[model samples]
Structure formats: structure tokens, C-alpha cells
Target: MTVLHEKLRGKDTGYWIIQCTNPLTHKRTTIRRNPKTDAKFKTKRSAQEFELQFLKSSMDLNMKFSGLFEDYCNYLEVHKSGKSLIDMKSRYNRFFVHLKNKKIVNIRESDMNLIVRDMQSNGYHSSYINTIITTMKILMNFAVKKGYINNNPIANYPKLKVAKTNDDLKFWTPEQMKQVIESIPEVYKTAPDVRQIQHIIRFGYFTGMRYGEIRALRWKDIDFNNNIININNHISKHNTERAGRKNGDYHQLVMDDDTRAVLTEIYENHKKQPEFTNDCYVFHSATRGPYFPLAATTGNKYMMKLAEANGLKHITFHGLRHSHASYLISIVGLSEAEVADRLGDTVAVTSKTYAKFFNQARVRAANKISSHKLGF
Candidate 1:
């Protein structure tokens, strides 16, 4: 801390001078502060405090966007790091290379507008570009909290409106799911990789389990007596074992008759193998033995290949979860809250995602009420 003692308004006062070096440009910066407004100039602690606070808010004036972003990424690494951290670094470096050297305070709306227009012109999906923009907003929000900037510039920009397509509704019915499952030739089932895909897809459809949860599931998680699959952890996209789920909920899916049957079938078959262990992955990796989890991408590619070739709609592994949710809402007539609980999601998300199914449920209720005999 550099303190300057000088005459201010005919009174001798101690002032704080902050020196911030921009890491990106390697340029030296000097910022002087008068402690008269918020701090008593006599105390040394006030000058120190003034220096600290000035670094935060006026930082935007001193540091470039990339330098602040690196600091923000470091902050996130300690607080909330994930596969997304890696993705953000790559994304920003590629697209917003120009923003790297510009001071955080100078990053304006017009600069963002040009980036969006370029991305749109390049055939990038609105949803994908929206995700990129969201990361920027989150970073800018961090800057605001740290006093890097007074307000987030990107916050005011509207997300590119995504057009809804049938591609968005990429789920299958019970019959469709069954057809795709059976479409795997009986001969291919002899291969461990093919069998693993066959079973995992079926599991995803019936249980509404995320690919992460399914890959992370251990043989120990199956409670035969209680008929529940304890979804204790999620394997992140980076293939790391996250202790809790995405929503931070410890979920246990009570197995339906179909789910229980599927679980039992896998256990009965898997128990016979020498590789089987109590703590082994329920959906064990075909290539990596019982210790490692099955790869989601490999399963998706092979599963889609067989299904698409046989005139079945392509339902990727994640689509199986959606298919299950659609089934619960439409076939079983489960409430939004009930579906959300079963799927380890919030009711609001369930309602929004399966809106058409809920609308159909409303129609069914209307028909039932009109046919009722009880009247005044």
C-alpha cells in the first residue's frame, strides 16, 4: 500500500495510491485515491482499505478483458469448476480474441452485437450462440461483484430467439423405444459393446436416468427388496465423479415393474461374469471391464446407427430420458410434481419441457368432468 500525505482543502490528509499492472498488456497503471469521502485520512488502515476497494471497482479501468476473465476463471476453479470451465476458455479465445486486450470498462454493446451477427452468419445455432452469450453475462456479472465494472454490458442484450422445430421433440413412444431396442440384431448382442449399448439405452428409456447417472451407477446401488436405484452421483461431462446430482439432490428412483425387470436381468447375467464386483459399474464399460463406466458417446453413435438403419426414429441416449418423462406425463397421467420427482428435476422445468403432454392431460380432465353424473 502506497500512502501519500498531502494538504487537501488546507488539511493534512493521508491518501492511497494503487498501482495495477495489466497482465495481458504488461503495462503499468497508477491510480490515486482521496480517502476523505469514506475513510478518515488519519488512520493507516483506512488507506489500506481504500486501496483494496479501489482495486475491485476501478479494476475495469486498469485491467484488460482477458486478464479479468483469467482471474474470473481462477475464481471459478476454486468455487465452481467443471468441464464448462475448459469450454469457456476455448470459446472466448476463439471468438472474442479482440476483447482480450480491451479494458473491461470499454467492452461495449456494439462490440457484442458484431460478434453475435458473425456467429449467426456462420450458421451457428441460436441456442448454441445463446449459451456462449450466457457465459459472457455470467463473467460480466462476476466483474460487477468484484468491482471490475459498475454494470454488466452483456446483460441488456436479448438472446437470439430460437425457432421451435420437430427436431426439438426428439423423443420416442413405448412402441418406438421397443422397436429400436429390438432392432439390434441378435448376432450383435454377442459383442460386449453392442450388448452394453442395448442395455443402457433400455435403462435410460425406462428409468429417465441421465447418461451420467447411468454411467456412475454401481452394482451396490440396486436395492432389490426396496426396488430402488440410488442415484447418488453424476459423472460430469469431463468424466469426473460429482458427489451429488446436477440439482444437488440425492435421488433414489423407485423402480417400476419394467425397471426392476431390466435391473434383475442385468444382475442375473452380469453375476455370472468373473469381472463382476459389488462396487462395479452397473453399466460397465465393454472395453474397460467392470471398473470403468460405459462411454455415453460410443453408445449414442452405435445405438443411433442400428436404429436409424431399421427405419426407427433416432433417439440418442439423452432422448431416452425425455422419452421416459413423456411416457410418465402422457401414459401414466402423472402430475408435473410427480414427474419432476421421478426424473430428479424441478416441477417448473418438467411443466415447461413436457407442456404438450400437460395440455393433453387438461383435455382428458375436461372430458372426464363433462361426463360426470354429479351435478346440482
Candidate 2:
């Protein structure tokens, strides 16, 4: 009943194994079946029927690797955020291309390893290569759960090592940020995009919200009386869809007078627009409708142009969040937990990321202590 005439056994042989779970003990078991005859089936459907009879289970064996990928994509669309779904599709597309026409049970760790090496040789960053490998591992695990493959082919696959340094985490100085924001109006004139970019930059600097969070802002999310911003929605990078913020949850932040002022001005202007509505995005494209958000590329490009024009050190739009955190911890004297709350991160992550800035604060305190004796 086997469709594949190729006898594949052991871990090295490229063949798919059927994975099933015991109902009583909840333990997983793998079943490998070989045909009695050397005849190869003409159609994938016949092979599936034969596999079902041999295993005495309803799990279909005719699913191609590509077909399994489509099911995986469907799973992602339901369970994952829009950004994560987009990222997975982009990475898995390359993997599908490499493992074309192969059955899910027929893919081996060696095939995955070859793809990893190829990606490495293509000059991708170590972090990115690791991500690609991780994507494969996730798919294989999904296949196992769906009873297509018995085990994860690259479960033991090693991730490429990524180097880290202080300089790798880029942030703008307070002075540089001020200069860039000030120069935006002069550089871009009276365009609606300039206003949107300015507002996004100011929001990032003061609130430490991620790019997606800021981009997904809606008029209704702003509470003018309470001076609070309800971060309940996020627009994906392509501006094609919306979802919960990066953590798949909502967050709230109290706004300062300056931030409230900026929002007030924008809201008033928004009210004047013909397309303005309660559900309108806070930052929208100049050409697109008012409810639509701007694309990530366009926002980043505008920020970069502003930095270059103002003779300031260039940092991506996300860098503004880091800058906000650094200023809050080092200059505003906020506690690590408070900063973490503002940035939607744990205290440990905030401390580790801004350890250098915290050290500088300690040095300043030491200088003050040495300069003055205790009055007691």
C-alpha cells in the first residue's frame, strides 16, 4: 500500500513517519510502514489510502510538503499576530522552494542543514539565519502535531551565534532628538506627512511605545479627560491589517501635558478633514484615506531623511523608543519597573538594556556625594 517505492529507514533516510498520540497515557508514538511489493503508486491519493490502511489510522499521508505549509500558514493566520504571520510566510517561502515536491515525511534534518548552510553562505546576518532555522523548526513541529511527520527534523539543530555589543543598540541623544524634531517643519514644509511624522516622533520620544503601537493609534484610543492613551490596536508594517500590539495585549499610558497638546492639535485638525471619524488612524498617509495608516518603509524613510537633513546621528524609528527609555531612566530618575511599564517590557529586560546609562547615573551621584559632606 506504500506509494513511495524508495525504502527509507533510519534517521538519515528521507521519509515521512506517522505520529500518533495514545489516548490513555497521552504519549506520542511514531509508526513507520514499508510496502510488501516494490511497486510505486501512480497517484498521491492511492499512496494516502495505502498508508491509512497500513497504519489503521485516519491520518492522511498524501499531503505534500507544500500542502502542509499551507495548513501551517492557516494555523498562523488564526493564532499569530499579523506581523508574525507576515514574517513566517516570508521565511518559510524560501524553505518551501528548497524542499519542493517532497512529502512532509520525506524531509530530513540533513535537508534542513543544507538549507541553513546555503542561507549562511548567502551573507545573511547570524540573527536572521537563526530566525530562518527557527522558522523551519516551528513548521516541522507543527507537522508532527498534525500527524504528518513523526518527529521534528531539525529539533536538535543549533542556532547561529549572534554577537552583541553596546554600540549595536542604537539610540539618539536628547539634544539630537530635539534638533531633529525642530527641523522637521522647516524641511518638509506644510505637508500632512510632515505633521504625521512629527507626531509619531514626539509620541515615541515621550511614551516609548513601539512603532506599530504608534502607527495603530485611533482617535477613540485617546482619553483627553483622563490624559491616557489606550494601546489596544497595532497596524502591521505594510499597513494592510490590524492586530493587538506586539505582545498581543492592550496597555495604557498616562500622557504628559506636551503629548496631550500634540494629540489635541492633531485631533482638532483631524476634525477639520472631510474623512475624519472616531475610528480614524492617528497617523495616516497623505494620499491614502484618513482611516488608513502609513507604511513602515515610508515612515522610516522620512525619519532618515529628517536626520540627515538636520545633521543628526541617524537611527531607525524604533530607536526613538530606546531613546525614550534612556531619558526616563537616566535623566528623569524613573525606576526600572516604571520605565518597563512605559515600554511594555519586564524590569529585567529594561535594566539589562540600559545598564550603561544607569552606570552613568551612578557616576553623577558619586560626584555629587564627593563634593558635599553630610550636614549631620
Candidate 3:
């Protein structure tokens, strides 16, 4: 192996010579009278120590903020599961664009605070701000671990406070649900676009599956004998592309008789169409290759029309999932934990958000007890 040495000069005319070998080329290089020489040592032991410290600092300085961010995104793609990689990529890309010119070490708590405050001031919700902050923190932490920075600026940053809204907990009553179901046009059951929409609605109510999970459903994931639908994958739209159709990456959800019957009907209908055979999606758009899970705005518009036609108040499609959970807990008498498991929600979230429905159910139960005791 070849070694190289050179002397570097200090601002005050002081200089030190440093020696090191290039690992890749196995070539030796030495620097003499370097600016950092004044802090040098006379003994070989002291020289070795000084060289090690200088090399460590040099390596740290060589780590670029942009490089760290790229590695962080790659880490997310490889290590993070459940969320679509496309979605993660989009979010990270937006964050990177915003932070492109900023140095990782220069990012401070005040900078984050200002960015968060600006977002909030511009009418962005706390949830959205939280997601941005989360992405930023992930990258910053990665930089710290890579020796690019000594500390993570986001470590002590205040979290955005998400305000609860009635929409967040909205659910349809049984009468309202029945009205909407009855009002759906009979032709929708047969028409390709409407059929998919009908099936999506029914599945959401019966299985509490999200829009993405419902769209990603394939014939293979369904186990009719076991009455279960595996939710191992989700269909998400990011960068105008549909993703979430792969293997061993989806979750499983139980299918009740109602949901099974609806799915079976759709499947049978699809099989009759020569073009839309078993190979096609269970719920697909006629125009679009397969339904990309309608955007939130479009889905809301359809939901509003459905509600109005049924003589019911407007409710979003997600309200169907909430209604399913509410019905299970209140009318069906399922425990909170059971409701959580069926809805793919954490027990704590289920209990906190849906506990009010249980309170009402308990009151009704008490009324029944009193009426029975009053025996006229």
C-alpha cells in the first residue's frame, strides 16, 4: 500500500504535517505544515491521537445534508411497511424540495417552529403539519446517526395540536343507512362503474375496510370457506399511479354473510362479461384500467348525492366505516375490543371515539330494565 503526506498552513503561520493512506486506492498521502498543525503532538502516540481526531472531523464535514436525506428516503422505502412506497416517496420529495438548499446542521427548533406556524397560518391542519414534521424529523435523525450532525433539532420541537371535529366521528343511523341502501338505483347493481361503487359502499359498511383496502382486493385474498378477506395490500393513488397490489404485504379482515353475498353477486356478474372475467379487478372502472379509489373530493360528492337521494343528511364515505363500528358496538352489542378488531382500529382509539355510542346503549339498557320492573 502507498502512503502520502503533505503539510498544511495555519492562519497564524503555524503548520502541521498529516499522514494517511487512501483506503480505495491503497495509496499513502501526507500533508505537511497544515493549518491545524499548531494543535499537533511531538510524540508518536500524540500524533496518532491528533490524526484520528482530525480524520473523524473531516469525515463528519464530508457528510452532505442532501446525501443524508437520500439515504433516509431509501431507509423508509426499505424499512417502512403498510403505507405505499409511492405515497412515502411523494411526501419525501415535497419535503426535500422545500429543504433542498438548507443544511441539516443549520436546521434549528426555531426554523421548524416557523415552518409549522406558517403552515397553520396558511390554513393547513395540524394533521398535515404533523406529517411534514414527522418526515423532517426522520431525515434529521438519519443525518445525526450518519455523523453529519451532533444533534437532532426536532428532538424537542413541539408537536402540532390536532383539533377534533364532528366529521371525524360521524356515522349514519340504522334508519339512514337503510334509506340510502334502498335508494341506490337498481341499474347500479349491474352497470360496471355503479356496480363497483355499490360494492365499495357495501364492503365498507360490512367489513369496515378503507377505500384503499377495498380497491386493492383481489379474488385470491378472499377465503369464502373461512369467511375472511385478507387485507394484506392496499390500493393507493400517488403521482397519478395505482399501487398496493403485491404479495404478503396486506392485512386480513373478517367478512360477514352480508359482505360475502354482495361480493359473490359482483363476482358472478363480472364472470359473465367476456372482457371482465376472473382476471379483472373485483371492483373496477370501465374506463380506467381499474378503479384508483376515487379522490376524496369526488367520493364526497357521490356520497352527498346518495345521502340526498335517500332523504338522509349528507355524510362522507368514511362515515360508512364509522357507522359499521357504531352499529357493532351499540345495536349488535359487540364489546369495544371486538369493535376495534373488526374495524382495524386500536382499542384505545375505538374506545375514545366510539365510547359515546356505548353510553347511549347503556342508557337504553337501563330503560329496558326499568320498563320490565314496572310490569303493568
Worst 10 residues of 2 by lDDT: 1-10
Better lDDT candidate (1, 2) = 1
Best by lDDT: 1
What are the C-alpha RMSDs, in order, of all predicted structures?
9.4, 11.0, 11.0
Give one digit per residue, the lDDT tens place, for model 1 in 139-224.
78887776666789878888889975434868888887777778766636666466566777788888988888888999898899
C-alpha lDDT score of every prediction, in listed order:
0.76, 0.74, 0.65
What ranges in model 3 sit over 4 Å off?
A: 1-125, 128-158, 161-167, 182-192, 237-254, 275-279, 290-301, 304-315, 374-376
Better of 1 and 3 by TM-score: 1
Rank the candidate models, highest TM-score first: 2, 1, 3
Ten contiguous residues minimizing lDDT sum, candidate 3: 1-10
Cα lDDT tens digits for candidate 3, 1-376: 1122333345423334556543234456664433555454334455445555554555344444555556666676787754545665677565446655565556778777777877778988789888878877877877666445677878777677786753468778777777666666652555447655666777778877766666656676677889888775665534132444232244567777899899888778766766653346565655665323345344566678787776676778778878888889788988888887787777887778787877887888899898788656
Higher-ranked by lDDT: 2 or 3: 2
Error of 2 at 200 (Å): 1.5
Q: What is the lDDT of residue 178 in candidate 3?
A: 71
Best-first order by lDDT:
1, 2, 3
C-alpha lDDT of candidate 1 relative to the true structure: 0.76
Per-candidate TM-scores read 0.61, 0.63, 0.54
TM-score of 2: 0.63
